[model samples]
Target: MLIEPLLEIRDVSKTFPQPRTLLEVLARQPKRTLHALRGVSLMLRPGETLGIVGESGCGKSTLGRCLAGLHTPEGGEILWRRQPLSDIRRADRSRRIQMVFQDPYSSLNPRMTIAQMLDEVLFVHAPSMSSAERRDRTDSLLQMVGLSPGLKNRLPHAFSGGQRQRISIARALALEPEVLVADEPVSALDVSVQAQIINLLESLREKLGISIIFIAHDLNVVRHISHRVAVMYLGQIVETAATETLFGNPQHPYTQALLSAIPVPDPDIRSLQVGVQGELPDPLSPPPGCGFSTRCPFVMDKCEKPIPEFFDSGGEHHVRCIRAHSSTFSVPA
Candidate 1:
């Protein structure tokens, strides 16, 4: 029997309106909405890391914010164990789903010490806890993220980028959340630091058994931790598959282009950056057809037509391309 997913996102869409400039406002221009997410759907299995990879402005961050309830969707549903996420009580939701933001410095309060921040979180989430228990728990959280309890009284400014991020991770886990939405948790750190944070997250996931939605533009980073990967383009998921299956044999044009760009170790077999022509279309007025059609190397006449639905490549892999059924559209060697 198949186990139900911890989170079910079905056709969730989020749009943000552009604030009118003085000239536009004076001219009485029509308000335009940026389609941050359009009919996005995916299943986040319990205790599995689902990596979301995409170009900048492709709605990866927006999707994370939507999952964390920072931005409410304009359409569709987000289900937590088959129950509507919106209906869950605020405090209950906070404990169940937590988000570790991209920038640790910005996410943490400079005025509050590390211990104070952790204590505040515990107080809010577990108000019935005794002061002694809270302190114990705070120290445990810091240690769990590989930080010293002595630094608990230190400000965020005193910590390195990686240390600060660990604190951010610790804060997110303070409530013992079942799901963690990590949005580029290590992107701002040094290369060495990125590896450290990634290992910490992997260890935490294994130990805590918490499902993670890891969003990052770095394919290598996503590949290291994700059980499955979803590729997004222009506010929609163009392809999704098991980690190895996607890297070994990507079907979608956008996904293929992305994977091809990864550098290889062999000098004779250097990575080829597939010249995917054109740039991402403006979300304010997206193309009528597939979002990646303009950049797709295998473009066809029908590709310009609106895609009403996605085509499944196999039971495990899914692709939004109309040519998903054709083998000729495979990425060049």
Candidate 2:
């Protein structure tokens, strides 16, 4: 049987106009525009976590904001269970998808206590619920995220960074959303804390049957949290595959470089950095053809023309590279 995905983002794109200086403006000129997301598409199934991994400025956060309705997409549609996301009723859509920001410190309101924060979420989505029911749900959420309900009286400033994130999670779950778009959820925490949050998110998915679109710059961390991972360079997803396949056997040159950069925790495995050298290209105006072609070590003439079709290399793995299909391109051993 075929199962329809909980969310589908189709051919989505977002472009932001760059700010111009006084001189440039006076001269009747405009600063170049930034193409944040260029035709990005993906699906999120029920009870599954899909990770989007890339470096900073790769537009992963931009994509998250768009899906969260914080930023409107310039083109294409974001569908929630086969219905257009924008056209749906606001109250109805809010229950379907929620966002958990990367930094817990800034996300929470310092003026509001934990109880107040949680109550706000409930008020927006479940206003009719009695005070007792809202309190019970909030308490349950706090405990589920490994927090204490008694701390509800404390302001966000009173808690540690990790605790604040737990509160953020509790608030996101207040609406019982089917899909959670977590943007770099643990990037701001200490290494030890990062692990705890990742584990907590993983545990919550299956228990709640909540699909998650997990965004992180760290490939290793994304690999740990996601069932499938998509590797993005600049503003485009170069490759996507099941967790094991993407790490064990990456197809795109950029994906290989990214995986190779991940440090092997074990002394048994080699600790050399096999990552690509040089700076990332400008997103304002990407290369003429393939966005990664400039950084791709295996650049070819055909690659300069245009990106090849997004092809599946058996199973659910897909890569947007000519090399994936043709022997014309091969990684040097």
Predicted structure 1: lDDT? 0.90
Output the number of the lDDT-best candidate. Answer: 1
Q: What is the lDDT of residue 45 in candidate 1?
A: 89
TM-score of each: 0.95, 0.94
lDDT of 1 by residue, 1-333 (tens): 667999999999999999989999999999989999999999998999999999999999999988888899999999999999999998888899899988999999999999999999999889999999999999999999999999999999999999999999999999999999999988999999999999999999999999999999999999999999999999999999999988877778788788768876754333333667877789999988888888888788888988637777776799898787666655445
- CA RMSD of all predictions: 1.9, 2.3
lDDT per residue as tens, model 2, 247-285 = 877888888777777766754223322457678888887
TM-score (C-alpha, index-matched) for candidate 1: 0.95
Give the Cα error of residue 39 in candidate 1, in Å.
0.5
Candidate 1 pairs with clashing backbones: none
What's the distance in Å from true for residue 184, model 1?
0.6
Off by over 4 Å in 2: 264-275
Top-TM-score candidate index: 1
Query: Which parts of model 1 have CA positions greater than 4 angstroms off?
Result: 265-273, 327-333
